[model samples]
Target: PAASEGLPRPIAGIGRPVTAQEIAGWDVDVRGDGEGLPPGRGSVKEGEELFVQQCASCHGDFGEGLERWPALIGGRGSLNTDQPRRTVGSFWPYAPPVFDYIRRAMPYATPMSLSNEQAYALTAYVLHLNELLPEDAELDAEKLKSIRMPNRDGFVPEARPDTPDEACMSSCRQGRPVAVTMDSRRFVQPGSGSGFSEPQ
Candidate 1:
């Protein structure tokens, strides 16, 4: 009867259910309160070594970031600057995310290859570079939550609305109607049309 029913109406679900071990490997999200962090220990000293070899290139020797690259340290009193450098020390709200992020994605060319202990050590080292943690400090899942960021209070909830409901189709500015002063096409190659030259 099942064979006559056209392969039993085809299976509703195709693949086997994911096992707990598989879930554990992929669902390693570290929460803000340090929940879901794996059990591992690392010291700042250990971090410095790994960072120099694995992280110093893009992030700079002290997490200062290469030219035009993302910096991980400094910028402590720069949130209000004209051009602020939003490094981990300056903008990140928590430390656990740093550890989780580094473990998940880091070293640019390589990702998700650091051992848990290495990740913890790198986290501590980055904090140390930021002047948040002591050079000799150790960080673990339990200790990571206690760390605070310089700009932790830099951001706050804005209860009030930031935009108006009115739809502005035109004339949104207070100044006199601006005139077209310059044409960008003049600066382009073959400014009259497409950049390609016409055939002879």
Candidate 2:
């Protein structure tokens, strides 16, 4: 008996072409400054209830962050410190993108499972938790896009006009090594996993 073994050829372009509807379905990206937002409405009150059932397990009942999950509400003025808590209220720069992030990935146990209205509600709720939005604020594309982030001006964009690709080839300087601090202040929750971490 002879074994059938030989070099395997690469298979490319074997799948069917994507339809317009399918592409539209998956291309649900919401942009900053209020573009690409779906039509829906959400309120802080609606968000509070949904947050408890769907989000509280990891984010906690108050968005204080469960163990090392991440504190979503506070950290208003700690960005200047060496170790910043870096929550939505403290670090995020825009509002529309907040909706995008939540709608895309949240409730770790289930991502992209929330309806547009639910996503809007959750977005409003997280903002309400941070005290950025009023308790009765109604969130929509226009209003959400207009909300200002606390550290909106905290970032300074890099403009290396003087430095070119050719300059980098000859006189580029290496970056200094960064200091790593392992703080013991962090505690783990009962069922929270460790090792790899995901996007905030």
Note the Cα lDDT for every prediction shown: 0.86, 0.85
lDDT digits (tens) for residues 1-200 of candidate 2: 24546756558978788998898789878876778888898999999999999998889988998888877888888888887778889998888888888888877768889999999999999999999899999898888888999988888978668655564564345665656686434765445554458775
lDDT of 1 by residue, 1-200 (tens): 65587555557679789999999989978987788889999999999999999988888888888987788877777778797878888899888999989998987779989999999999999989988889899999888989877777778887688777898777776667878898776777544555447674
C-alpha RMSD for every candidate: 8.2, 11.5
Backbone clash pairs for candidate 2 read none
Model 2 ranges with Cα > 4 A deviation: 1-19, 159-200
In angstroms, how far off is 80's CA in candidate 1? 1.9
Where is model 1 more than 4 Å wrong at Cα? Answer: 1-15, 158-161, 167-175, 179-200
Top candidate by TM-score:
1
Best by lDDT: 1
